[model samples]
Target: MIPQPTPAAPPRPARILIVDDSAVMRALLRSVVSSDSRLEVAGTASDGASALRVIDSVRPDLILLDVEMPVMDGLSTLRQIRARPTRIPVIMCSSLTQRGAQVTIEALASGASDYVAKPTGQPSREAAVQALAQDLVPKILALTALGSPSHGSARGHASAFPLSSPAAPPRTPVTANLAFSTPPQQPPSGFAPAAVLIGVSTGGPAALDLLLPGLPAAFPLPILIVQHMPELFTKHLAERLDSRCPLRVHEAAEGEPVRPGHIYIAKGDWHMEVSAHSAMPDHHSSSAPVLRLTRQAPENHCRPSVDVLFRTAAAVYSGRLLGVILTGMGHDGLAGSRILRQHGGVLLAQDEPTSAVWGMPGAVAQAGLANRILPLNAIASEILRLSARSQREAPDLRETDPREAGASGIGWVTP
Candidate 1:
């Protein structure tokens, strides 16, 4: 009889340490991690002091840290852990509040690997649990694969990536039509959208640094963005972008109207949407469009999920909408893009060469979702061209046709 090879030995389980003040939270995490046979709950701690002691004793492969603790919070714990030169990967668990969001960003900056939003009271337990398992677990696995030695170096290198190069600011204007042959389909009622929606993550800050400043202050379109960032970091990002760009930029308020010449960022812990307002008979004052913000359950494991914003825009704006998806780590925006495409809305994605992580954009591109995939530098110019095209094609407008406008006295300006 032929000898049979013995079954391969089972792989070692990844040891994990759970740190949280709440007994319930600790139990929940333990249960989840334990459910995965590849993961083992090595130890548990209530605060930073206990966590630090456990870290030295157990030397776990991963740590799930809660941002709010009685004695020492997640941020303080992260700092302490990093200072000791231990290389264990940490995933931060945060509440879906503005303050919580800010703290999560700080944790990332300070050296925590990744974060997941702790469910707010409003969302059901099932939704909250799903968000944590889907989003946080994947991030933890990805960060751990980077290994301890390379983690610090990767962070430093990523930070140094240029926001925008000053020398190439005024290169040849790359129009959208020239880059892609197929023209955007004419809207059903010839109604052009008044605003643009953008969803970006991972390399977003750097990409925005290049794109935002190129836009003119008088550019007559409102822009709503759902960038994957911690709450506090987003405020800093807005301030930074506002200073550099000519347009007004601010975090979205609960019920603020979406208007031209302004940018609204989705606030941490709340999903932001644009809705139509009933037109008053008077028509004298500015139209009061309603902007909705909700503490609803996260979609695709993100509180201010790109999918939520994109789907809402697809429904409200329909054929008038322009949806742009940028570099990110997962397939959060794919479903929403399908909605946009079905409604005759335009879709754009960042090219893979310029992406920090190509997972998000790649999914869209591979599935034939994006109408145009352009380099990071060319995105702003494409937006300008598309907006201009929409305006020129508007049925009610008596403006000169684009072909005639190009041949005639009106000079095409790139902003």
Candidate 2:
């Protein structure tokens, strides 16, 4: 009989430290974390101070930190955590209220890896647990790099959410003919980008805090952004960014004119698209694009999906568009980026090292869709450089049929 080879030991589950002032909340989070075999609860802390005291001993792969806690609050603790040499990923567990959203944004800007709104208004404890699991578990798996065969059930739960597990299969294109050939490594000569569309999630608030402010108020192109978030949070995010940036930033509204020097963030729960509005003969000769918002079904398990926005922007702007995919979880922007690239649009992806989770942008980068992959800090300068190019210096590439340009029609779908 042939000797059997020794079985290799399985990888250890990622350890998590739960920190919340409420014992009940801590217990709930522990239950959620424990339900996934790929994850283990290393310890629990009542507040930020306690968490800081035990962090070294617990050696958790990630932390689920509550925004409002007794003693040292989440932000204070987060700042201290950043001061430390060892960096552990911290996921802010916040309430769905306005104050919660405000504080969560601050924590994110301060260096929290990501955030999940605590389940509220669910009819039952089980329902609440399910909601938390769907939101929190995938974040754990993504930020901790814990995707494995042992996490089967956990990954399945995550599939019900917007962020897909790493073990999941590559997403199928919405249309069969949408298959891409050799995507251009660089835009064709004379590619003059008239508009900049950005898709970001996961670590977006902080990334945006760093990015939007970098663009001077005089930045020429209109910027449309899709940041995966719920309703109230998006509003608060807009308010926060607007106060800090030189350029005007606001939550996008229906029928607003898409104008240069202003930034529009897609409203939470509403898909934002652009449409050409024929100018009144008395007012102007050419049509101008206006923002259009819809209550479309969620794509990639997300409302206000990046693909939805990208697809429409590509159609409205055609070859004159520039699509930027930033730090995010899952592949929300991949399909859109593919379609945008097909339409002679330029693409930029945030590099992995600077990303909090790298799922969305990584997909674009891996698919050969990105014309450039730059660090978080470099994206603003590149955008400025691209937007400043003379439109007349190079003839617009929009005249070429996309199919003839080596791509096919975009089949937009919500799934």
lDDT of each: 0.67, 0.78
Candidate 1: misplaced stretches above 4 Å? 1-137, 143-160, 163-193, 230-233, 278-285, 390-415
Off by over 4 Å in 2: 1-3, 148-184, 278-287, 390-415
Candidate 2 to native Cα RMSD, angstroms: 10.1
RMSD of each: 10.1, 10.1
Tell me the number of clashing residue pairs for each predicted model.
2, 0
Which residue pairs show backbone clashes in model 2? Answer: none
Q: Give the clashing residue pairs of candidate 1, or none.
A: 101-231, 102-232
TM-score of each: 0.57, 0.84
What is candidate 1's lDDT per residue for 162-230, written digit by digit as tens? 322332123332233233324434333343565688887655666677778877654557789998775
Q: What are the per-residue Cα lDDT tens digits for candidate 2 across 1-415? A: 9999999998789999999999889888988998899999999999899999998888988888999987898889888877775667789999989899988888887778789999888998788888899989988988777743222112111211112234434544222222334443865656668889999988888889889988765455788999999888899999999889877889999878787767899999999888887333453533558888899899988889999989988888888898999888888988999899889899998766567766887778778898877777888877866765632343242223222233233221211
For candidate 2, what is the TM-score? Answer: 0.84
Highest-scoring model, TM-score:
2
Q: Pick the candidate with the highest lDDT.
A: 2
